[model samples]
Target: MESVFEAFLSFYLNPGFFYGTVLVVLLILFISIFYRLFPNSGFSILFDYFFEKMYDFFEDILGNEEKKWIKTYVVILFFVILISNLLGVFLEILVPVFGNIADTDVSLLKKYIDIPTADINFNIAMALIGLLIIIFEQFRALGFGKALYEYFPIFGKNYLPYTRGNLNPIFDWPLFILVKIFDLIISLFLGLLEIVGHFAKVISLSFRLFGNVTSGGMLLAMLVGAISGLTLTYLNFEFPVLGPVILYFQSLLVALIQALVFPLLIAIFIKVAKFA
Candidate 1:
């Protein structure tokens, strides 16, 4: 009970959790604005025009309409992910402070600064959304019957039950039926595994983003600390002014990469879904 209480308290007090929630809210606001400014029809036209240009760029790499569609999605995904990742950059300043009567606690209440992809829930939610898009594409491509057949293979009578002069015909039919039954059962299990794998992707994606960003920040913090320590050791610790400048540039590059990666991967996911 005590451990559970402590765990709950830690989760509630987590800065990342709160920051992620705030960032999500802000993202929704911007998305709403975009929708309000350009309704589906208008956005579709704009997307189509750009999508065509993108398709042309990938002309050498991918052939046919199917390939072009995937390329189009990838481009759009890059933008969304990139923007969300960098939302933290604007909140580099404005650290929060909390105080209490019992222990005079101080908490960093950041006005801004959130790495959306760092949260597992956020990554999983996006992946699930992408999965839906993929399923929709599959439905559009093959219709219901073909899609079902693709997952569940069934041999027809026309293709079998012949050229059996040397074997028992009755026995062969039962054997074939049993084989198909096993195949169907295996297919069901395979489907379950696929679902689990998708969830695994979400976990990996979230951890990758979180690990990269936090690790980079820690590195920069260490650099700054080391530089300041050396300065203090040699001379009355004036300030590691240059450390901030260098770290800031490094942070900028890292932030940009993370921002781009999120959307790029999403686009790839969309493309893969179409084929599935």
Candidate 2:
């Protein structure tokens, strides 16, 4: 019991652990304070305008879908992803600033700031779930038989369409049987191809999102490391945050682009699945 308590205490009160929590609290306080101090401030207007533009942008990309909630969903997804990416910006500075402050070995970054988008597994899981939702939508819109046909299209026009072309009133039995066998093989092959294609789409989409996010984070880390001694120094009585902070601002565009793109692709896929 004592060992467990000790472990919990160590984890809870670890060095540099509260920095991120404190910063998050401060940020929330700042925003609330702004709203309180100036109810009609330009900052509030600018923020509202930005959100309105984001809503319109997503709505345009999503088109006039019946599920209007999906547009709201995409907007929410964009915000979640953008916030996650932006939160990871300070990782390069977080550890450096506090690593030496504590006599213990643990660092600030170790305790705080996990960018979920950078994880391929997280992205892949999201892709899988999103694909599942699309499939469900297709089923709901097109009924069972047709939805299955959309994927397999086993009686595909070019492949088989039907073996009846070889089996006519003349009753060429052997030729008909041969054609049926051949088409069975073709249908099996095409079905497998379709399955593989679905899996490939999930992998490709997940990897693309993962690569973009991780690359941005690594670029900032590399730039910070390059000048950690010259300017971004803990010993130089500096905050060690400027380089990372600038890189953070620079990354905002990519964050927005990625947030917009990921959902747009999913929406496009859903639309195609519904109509195709």
Structure candidate 1, residue pairs in collision: 77-263, 82-259, 96-109, 98-107
29-60 per-residue lDDT for model 2 (tens digits): 67568967886899877766776787787677
* Model 2 misplaced regions, further than 4 Å: 1-44, 93-95, 99-107, 152-184, 229-246
Task: Provide the TM-score for each candidate, comma-separated.
Answer: 0.59, 0.68
lDDT, residue 244, model 1: 66
The lDDT leader among the candidates is 2
Error of 2 at 94 (Å): 3.5
- lDDT of prediction 2: 0.67
For model 2, give the 10-residue run with minimal summed lDDT: 14-23
Q: Could you give candidate 1's per-residue lDDT for residues 1-276 as a string of tens digits?
A: 448855674667555555566665677577658766776767656855755665564443333555555565655555455555455443332221221124532214331234565556666776666566656666677688765654444432222334333458778677767756676666666656656766766666666777776576557556766786888889776456677677767777887777556555555554565565
The Cα RMSD of model 2 versus the native structure comes to 5.8
What lDDT does candidate 2 reach at residue 71? 72
Model 2, residue 11: C-alpha shift (Å)? 12
